[model samples]
Target chain A: MKSLIDICDLSREEIDSLLDTANDIIAHPEVYSEKCRGKKLATLFFEPSTRTRLSFEAAMYELGGNVLGFSEAQSSSASKGESVADTARVVSCYADIIAMRHPKEGAPLVASMHASVPIINAGDGGHNHPTQTLADLLTIKREKGGFDGLTLGFCGDLKFGRTVHSLIAAMSRYKDIRVVLISPQELKLPSYVKRDILQKNGIPYTQTTDFESVIDSLDILYMTRVQRERFFSEEEYLRLKDSYILTPEKLRRAKSDLCVMHPLPRVNEISTAIDNDPRACYFKQVLYGKYMRMALILMLLGVN
Target chain B: MNIDSIKDGIVIDHIQSGKCMEIYRLLDLEKLDCQIAIIKNALSQKMGRKDIIKIDAAIELDFDLLGYVAPGVTIDIIRGGVLVEKKTPELPEKIVGVICCKNPRCISTTEQELPQVFRLADRERRIYRCFYCESMSK
Candidate 1:
């Protein structure tokens, strides 16, 4: 059975195919209104995530399918000490496909091993979030027309940002892509990511603490929040919390067509005043995320 | 100090100096009832200093654990006190239950029943990563 536990699990061709399907759905939503008719999607979220759970539920509803399962561990058998494998086995009997979110890394992988149906990892702690990467890819494709030869600037909390790691891994497969990592010394990209994905792929990249210094050369500025939950020390989190804030003034030297993006639930990292900028595509990215989820569900269910 | 040669046993040679005890502990040599000898910091022309282990029985060994703990070590199978076959353990592609992932966020850390798994991520650098979280095996 096919499952998406990591972004690297999908080949470049598969990602392109998914993007094509998403674009088609956007162009003609009526044609795919009932693509998953009579199917049931089980959303097993062990952690609390309003946005991702809603996106999955909304995707299933729009596909003429029913959504079931718990929103948190307290509401499910997990609180009673049921293993993820057991939960997946039981849920597989009812749902045609499953979207899982857990606070523990690789929980989806364990579920995928036991579940009879396909498993989609909505988010797994600070680990792989393949669906989010898919959303980001679709947004980049729509904005820049393609990934080739585009310079991407990743700002803030690169060390623990699973989305940034997954996107960099996905984009490394394309041609002539460069990266500009902008963050404080404490939050720079991990060395393994730099060595394995960027350096191994021969993609030229530069690291800097000053966001404005490299903002002009970027085609896409991916701003990420400095999540306090990922830090061990409150003092350290407070020290690095306001390291990089994207304001309208910072974009003065940037290109006219530069795409500014943030995986939502922003925490003052992005100024509200910049929302009106024509290049700000974060909200559109959210909508595209739903469409991509719809496409993914159809693909996994073999309806597409 | 002289250790007697085994009659029908196995000889593990060329272990990196100072790593024999780790290999011994991980291999659970203390659980074995058969006679075993560990020669540590022995002079070697190839490795400058090396360790060797002699087992007085032909019991099966966990080659994966051996390969992971002491790569490039040689194993000799003896029959009638004569060497019958010489084997070299290579870095295993996957290791299960040999080492636990220390990453607290890893699923293996929370799921106690799950087998601790690791895969060789970089062969040249001799680096292994937890199969679940991809954190480097320290």
Candidate 2:
């Protein structure tokens, strides 16, 4: 009856349960492989996302579920001027659950109204990607050993980074978590985030333009690229593009146990040379994404 | 035109003039067989132009539905040609099953089964967020 719509829908206990399920699926793959056998996952990707769509497909396939639906609006019934709700209604007859990615703000939310199946928001126009936050949670729990009492630093485009916003919202529930925000003046965390999630909950957080000065204090470093598209001018983006790239040299200033993370397809933000360092968990983050998704598939299908 | 007052009916007052027809259409008032009278461009001090709708039949109002289309409007119930009760709907705390959050990627939008549930994050400001997506509008 529940869907992974936003990270907030899952409480700390629910998230912990999902994580436990993920761990169990990882440890006992055979037991959960046929969990959703004969069920189908309908992927309604209105926007192009090869990676996320693939992850969902791969997750469903590994769970013995058939995958259907379009990769883009151009290929689907969307070309026939069908509304998101109508598409979802028709698709529900064919699938047990739907994973949707759209460029519009709430297209998936609208579709949910008429759907007969659980709707998973794959991603929405810089709005939300709860599964990504789930993956990040798994990465943090695995890399840092636990969720509580950690100093986390989020650097780069905090303004439009749905990943960053979701992570902050999800982590605010944990104990003794300090957030050190690093971004240019224009691309900083929105006030609502600070007010609604941080201050309202009394989560300890500090903002700074100085990433280099605070690198050593952080236990987890989340790197997001400064999206040029979100900016109005090239000159402004150029000035802020390299403001906080994580290079091999920068890693020297960081603590030995610091884990570096990036939502990949990364540009010049995190240097390729730094991949050799044990602290770089961006690649490992991707693998953890699969495990977490596998865990989600099992949990949602009621097999776990 | 002068007309006799009804014994019981629901009166919608202070509707934005041109929007009354839209609200009527939104409520599908045409389907009703009741004698519904619509007053256009009525005099109002608060709103420069207002419309009024009086349905000359005993009709119960759905306050939750009223909140969606006419949150700013006030409604009065008349009994025996006397104003017996007045109901001014407050905006819903959480809007479910009506209207849409403008966020396309919001799960409520993409999935066919779930009703669009938006939390009225700011009532005075008329901001609603998807309960599933966190998509907001001012």
Candidate 3:
């Protein structure tokens, strides 16, 4: 009864197994359709994350499962003073599995404690989003063919991207993964991830404000937006905004095979011109996210 | 001065002062259906500042509230009007819906609809983090 609350919750073998299952599903979509014919996926999104919510719904629908639950807390029973425990107890009666996104940090964990079905954290506050981490892993695996010995570069908003934190957690579990953190000092990766995940795993990583100089060395350039609002002042955002943009001119210097990935709804950190480069995998990342989620919905429902 | 003993209860001790209200709001202690004694600014030799809350009918401390208020505070379980056990909440292994993670850019903070999830990664040193945005506050 393992719940995908965090990336590290799944071991390397388990991740590989999930990837393999996703690959099989991708290879033979028709055979896997209707795998969870009667099951229901409850997407209890307390926050309105249209992208993630749609992704989850699409995954469930494609799996031949029904989708239930609310996209916002204000419209749900939770707004009327129902504790997460009560909501979980009630939702479990209707759904085979639950994927919850709450603005609060520990909402999913609390729900998991009381849920009868396996609980998936769609996204919790600024905390971990295991599924996005899952999507990133699948995209990386499909692009690079494996998870070992690649120089993974994390660019922009390293300080607040839960995706970055979760990815570091997942990738740190693999061997010989060198990390290049390209961000302004204001948006540098938190000490916890750098210390707990990277340093503890003994993964070699270097930090710099410059991304171009190191572009050629990276096998993957992960782009995240550093919003001006995240900073104490616009001056700081302005100072660092250009410090990390992935322009086509910049991509010209990157490894010909380097994968350019962004967890989408991207701001201008990435230029549209670079989207045509075969290395730009962000759009494909979205499709893979859906397919991987389709794999997840089937897997968690025990139909895979 | 001798303190009045609770008949059968839990005593929250070493709470950093000025946080009784946060606990009050957290537990809604005012609406409690049980007898309770709350003493703020109580004398202490070890703690320069301390507060105590004694529940007359055995009550479990809302540990998340405790962790958020003061992570290292000790709690005593009392029975027969005597201290039968003393314990401290280990750092919360996972924090959810506790403190508003201080990161404003955090979806949890901005959404007005999500719980602030944090995991207690280092208990002894009192580290908790927002589960979504990954903001750390000690």
Best by DockQ: 1
Best by TM-score: 1
Q: lDDT by residue for model 2 over A45-156, one digit each (tens)?
A: 9878999999999888888889998898899988777778788889989998899998876666666767888888888777778888988998898888898999999999
Q: Model 1 lDDT vs. the true structure?
A: 0.92
- Per-residue lDDT of model 1, residues A75-163, tens digit only: 99989888988999999999999999999898999999999999999999899988988999999999999999999999999999989
Winner by DockQ between candidate 2 and candidate 1 = 1
Poorly placed runs, candidate 2 (over 4 Å): A228-239, B1-89, B94-118, B123-126, B130-135
Candidate 1, which segments miss by more than 4 Å at Cα?
A: B16-35, B40-50, B58-60
lDDT of 3 by residue, A1-304 (tens): 6567777778888788888988888898877778878899999999888999999998888778899889998999988878777898999999999999987766677788779998998987777788888889999999999989999999988997878888988888788999999888878898877888888889999999887778999999999987554466788777776666778888888888999998877878899988888999998888888887887776676774
As a whole number from 0 to 100, the lDDT of residue B101 in candidate 1 is 91
Q: For candidate 1, what is the interface RMSD?
A: 1.1
Question: TM-score (chain B) for model 3?
Answer: 0.78
How far out, in Å, is residue A35 in model 3?
Answer: 0.4
Give, for candidate 1 chain A, the lowest lDDT window spanning 10 residues. Answer: A295-304
Over all chains combined, what TM-score does candidate 1 have? 0.95
lDDT against the true structure, each candidate: 0.92, 0.83, 0.81
